[model samples]
Target: MLQRPTMPGYAAPQDLIRRVRRTWFLFFVVAIVIIAAALAGAEFYGRRSAIEALESQGRTDANLKVALLTAVLERPRALPLLLSEDQQVLDALSSANSQAIEILNRKLERLVTGTQAAVLYVVRPDGIAVSASNWREPLSFVGNDYNFRDYFRRAMEQGTAEQFALGSVSKRPGLFISRRVGSAVAPLGVVVVKMEFDRLETDWQSASRPVYVTDNHGVVLITSIPSWRFMTSGAIPQQDLASIRSSLQFGDAPLAPLPIKNPAILNPGASIVSAVLPGSGEAKYLRLLAAVPTTPWQLEYLVPIETPVASAVQTARLTALAFLLPVLAIAAFLLRRRQVSVMRIATEQAMREELERRVVERTEDLSRARDRLQAEISDHRDTEAKLQVVQQELVQANRLAILGQVAAGVAHEINQPVATIRAYADNARVFLERKQTDPVEENLGAIAALTERIGTITEELKAFARKGRVAPEPVDLRGVIEGAIVLLRSRFSGQLNALDAQLPPPGLFVMGNRIRLEQILINLLQNALEALGDRSDARVEITVTETSDEAAIAISDNGPGIPPAILDSLFTPFHTSKEQGLGLGLVISKDIVADYGGRIEVSSSDRGTCFTVYLLKAKT
Candidate 1:
């Protein structure tokens, strides 16, 4: 051991060891305190920021839902009002002529199809449904009495009325929009449009957040969760429930409080709540509400907060440690360097070298800590990115679900054409075996025509399934209608006398795909024929008319007419009355007409039914 002397202000080795130990201990204590304080502050601030972000997200979702609901609900408001002012509606209401009523029914049906309304009808002054858009469906509202409905009574008394309730016939929830027709003093009943939110609710269900719309009484009328529909946000008074029950507003639903726990009001229209989801256990959420414009309803949005909060806390801890470790290491190095300088002045070089070695070790430890913190931050970012990608996939999956719904009807439609083609081919083979070339030629021609029709139908199906649009051209209105009738001739051979067709001049044209236009006409004719099943005097009349800018094709039939029960969803996909009906005929027809800047409508009563297709005339 070489003699080592202490410099000024430097103690002996044992004393210096004690001082260094105390200094290290004090540094740790202070560093821990500082880090703890910094972590505490950071966690507090981060939690606040996360909560704010959650609230912001909830608010944005609430507003967006409100806007969507408002747009969908408001669209049909003008429809009822406009139709109420129509001269034809007033004439139909005043005259009570079966023909005029049928015509008005067709007009209303067209309006419903064009506007995508659940049902459009004109109530007589006596509160009887006179003409309805679903006149051709088994659930036609025509001839059904609606005298007891609040919307009808209110529209009769207040000039206009709006009511959200379960339809008495359809047994589904919807908003009834009604406007008084004719003069206020001599009002000729009410014009009504029912709007269903099933599609809207389906769209909402695809979102990550929980969302719903509640009426004035806090009863949830629309919700992404089907089970939550008709649930109450808060306790409902017995009297209110009784009244709602008596009115048949919600149709025998158990109006229980929503499944939420530990609700704490944070501010107006905002709350922090805990809820147990279907698959997920209890979780905290930031709940927000926004009022729907022009409606006494509020949209609620809920966002999960636990994930963000936990992430914030972890981030804060890692950041505090990251900064604190480096500072402690630097402080320790400086202290060791000072000790080395003092020792170098009086002691051997070995003592200074030992102190320098400790400094390097401390620096390396801090560097390692820093690297770990950086790795954690990178992992956090990667997790967040993955979460975003998962959200996008969820959204895309929802869209695919919609496409699947549309495609469900495809099998039914294609099956019919395929069956018809097979039947025609069999008939042609039989005729050819008998050497009846004329009949064989006729059957083959029919098969060829059907094959072409199938091609057009498949093309339309492909376009719809792909969410693509088809180009419109000048289509011969008469030719398309005749082609449709020709397709139906074999099926209606026994009732040929019952088919009445009146066509416009040969040159009449409309802006649409010819085959799609034929498809629309064929659907109407087939539906009419089916409705006229087994009736000896079953009749179907086709009339075409032209205007300066539009061409109209009216198909009227004397069938039993549509029933009121299924009228509300007459054009909805997969809704049908026939055992084999796919319920997509009217839906596809509506879509085709809409794509071509045209519309299809229907009116029905006990006397008969009529469907009208309106298309824009081709420019010369």
Candidate 2:
């Protein structure tokens, strides 16, 4: 079949044209879908970005307002304290007595009642009210005393006035300011200023919209919009007032305190963000809210929801048209001429080149992203490590606390024995001179016992040091108990006292660092002795009881039991009932027991106080 070269299944011109047309139809459909998707995405992202940017700007503005207000109110924070004793303002008020305060109050009422914020009161350093904006302020104030207030005293002592600042208006939403009267050298009283809702109304006139400044409390300081529902300040519901008040009085001191960072917003679900009044309910309104951390106030600017949307409508339409025109043109070009062989070839080559360029750009972007992720991980790990170190330091501090508590008794016990030893040796030297060998030997034996006691005391101290080393082993509970007794015996084994011990068998054991364990016993015993020291029938009893699973050593004294107030805080670091106490003993002892999976408890009543320590039984 040597026929002419067979062009197998090759498309004729008509068939080729039909296939090209079909491909073009499919591309046109795909292009339309892609363009629609891009426009929709752009609209969604743009709206969200716009909202976020607006909110951020609002917050910035609120912060600035709060800072300025705080700078004005700090003066008042001090005036309340200093006014009672200020010589000048007090002299002025005292000159008029009750009438003096009344007249001054009226003057202030005129100055502040119609202003943006209400003035609460102005008082002299001697604590007499000079003026007040609100009549109610006069009842509890005006000639009343302020001597007990620390704020007043500090202002006088410093002989300087506090600067203005922002705070809660009567703990509500308002602006407060105060200024000292007279000269700095011989100050008079202070001029207290407050601006509440009425004041806000004055300022609201300056703003275009129906605006109001409210605190976390729903208390409205100022508002331009007048609704019958919000006609009266007290008419506002309590919950709403509270919310607004809180928002207004937020801390303004930039250096006050940083919020906890782990979870940036301390309260979840609650809007840490500020928002516009939002039409009293869930009705959405365009609002700009700011969280002003300095004086920590929330500044809100509320507008009709329709306003922001309307303002943006014109721009939105222009952008949509701008984006849509190009997309339609590209789609149309793809549809037309697509059936031509030459056009198809060119389009295919263009698409391939575009894909290659995208691939190269994507590779570089991915590389940078990976590097950033690794660096973030490293930083996170370092932060975690630092937190762990801080936690350990806190733990070590607890250990030192207990040692510090018992140090006093330990010093007394050790020193008494040393003093007795010195006296006995000195007596022996005199006896030797008188040729009395027998008395000299007796004194020598007494000295040896005291020296041994001193050695035992030093051993207990070695365990109290805080360090990185842990040396725990099986130790006989009986021996530890007796060693503690021997160290305290010389000091407490006096004429009017009795000390007793009921130690368990030698086989009873606990696993602990020997020095630390002994130190704990000494601490408990010393506390018992001190408790019984002042009693004529002073008696201290020690009893050790054991079971298969655990062992307990109890110390009881026939003295007044632990005070109810101090019982709970006994083991807390740096807490003590004793006047001269360092307050570390129980805390250190508690930690030591916990380290070995043990516990210590104290019980007290009229019968007296008892401390019981339970240690896990070492395996036989």
Candidate 3:
């Protein structure tokens, strides 16, 4: 028989498909069994074990709460008993004197702070409160009568008594522990200690579990939930409710049944009960109880079991998956190995194609990298170009702004020249009429000279106002100083006459654009003139000092130096002492100087302010 042609190391298509199908069929069957077994085990045993665990924890917690309550109760229980036997309390009860009562009041006040008792007081045989710990407070118990209180009556009859009731005077509910002083035959009075459960209730709330303490009558005296207090654990008989109400012990409490429901006994001592607790909504708890020592109070602890039980079930399911997944993985590995053995030849060919694809991918990666580098380089060049444009714009703007400021002065200077030119022209016309050619020629020439002067002033202004950023070059210092003064002369006509400049030697030069250098000089000179402001004794000074590598020119003013407050911000843009000043003059000057690798320094005192401009010295 002839067989079909096959790849050297690959299985036949028909055999491969059949094996894959069988493998999937077996996997599905095994997975179904594993899941069913896991769920069944969790349902059958996990819930039972969870309940048992929670019940154990609930019992331990309940017993702990009972011990805590006992400790709180026992601490105050001795307070009244000890005070009853004390001489101070007995003396006050027997003395009936103001001095003894005052002494006992102070002692009780001090004792109450040291102990947990909210208030400690002594009552006479007739049940009138005389001396109390709260005597100093506004609602002092020093004069209150407690003859009708159940604790007072019970203690008078039995020598000692404990009762939890709402106080008639204070309106706050607390436990009253009272003890009879002296022997029953000659009883002095009752020493009563009122204890509040606020702190104990707060502790229970922190445990994150619902807890309540119910008295012999099933009325909740202390509970983690404040609203549950005075509520009964179950329904009370009409007659009993009436009797309790008549005693005036629980105040205006409704005495209704608690909101507990759906009780199911899980064990002899532990049961599951549902209740809607404050802030917790309705939930099931593992209910356990322990009697509060010496108080006929039963402490009920409720541990929420739903979360722990669900968690245990989930844990069981995970445990099952943990075992089942490994076996399935092993089976998958064996199948994978068998399949890979048959596919080795095909894998080699596929690998060759994959390698070619990777080579092509690497080439594309290189192309993308080159493209990114080119883009980054283009971005840098664009940013540099934009920076240069912005810098040129800034210099042009500052120049135009100064030119606008001095336009009026420039117009005034041109007007003077025009008036002289007109005068010379009139004279020339007269000379020509008189037939004096030489005089007419001279007059015409003078008029021409005046016009030329006007033209020169305007041309200087135009040059200052033009926009451009020029590369730094060696510039004569004298030319920059003279140029700035020429612009300011018209603006400050008389002020310029006071300028005392000590110019540097001829041929001395600094590296910077000449226009920008003149702008820096104009800013300094204009500021100094404005500061002098027509003072009779006003003086301005410009002194230039040069070194081989650097040159510094200092401009000083005798006018009241820049105000101490504004001196520091002199170079800060928009910070100005002048009410109408935009405050950009010195700032632009500082930037220009910095661009030429230079800086400006300013100093001011009571007598004067000085600004020094430093520039890099350049070869002439």
For model 1, how does the per-residue alpha-carbon lDDT over 563-591 read when each residue is reduced to its tens digit?
A: 87776678887789999787888998899
Model 3 Cα lDDT, one tens digit per residue, 1-620: 11222423223355645665776678679878877987889765777889888887678878888888888888888888789889988889898999999999999999999996889999999989999999988999978889988899889989999999998778898999999998888889999999998998998887768898988888999999888889887888789888788878998888878888888987665778888887668887788878887778898778888888887787677677778788878877677667555544444454345446645878775555546545754775698689989999998999997766567435633544565566667778888899999998887876776577677656644443352225689999988897667556645677777899888888888899776787678778878888888788888999999776789999999978877678767777568887756676777677778767799999988899899999998843
What lDDT tens digits, residue by residue, belong to model 2 across residues 304-389?
A: 33434333444454576677778777766655534333544544454445445645879775455546545754775698689889
Give all TM-scores, in the order shown: 0.50, 0.32, 0.46
Each candidate's lDDT (Cα)? Answer: 0.81, 0.57, 0.79
Candidate 3 collision pairs = none
Candidate 1 — which residues are off by over 4 angstroms? 1-30, 331-620
RMSD of each: 25.4, 30.6, 30.6
Better of 1 and 3 by TM-score: 1
- Model 2, stretches more than 4 Å misplaced? 1-21, 52-194, 209-288, 291-296, 303-620
For model 2, how big is the CA root-mean-square deviation? 30.6
Give the lowest summed-lDDT range of ten residues in model 3.
1-10
Model 1 Cα shift for residue 121 (angstroms): 1.6
Candidates 1 and 3 compared by lDDT, better number: 1
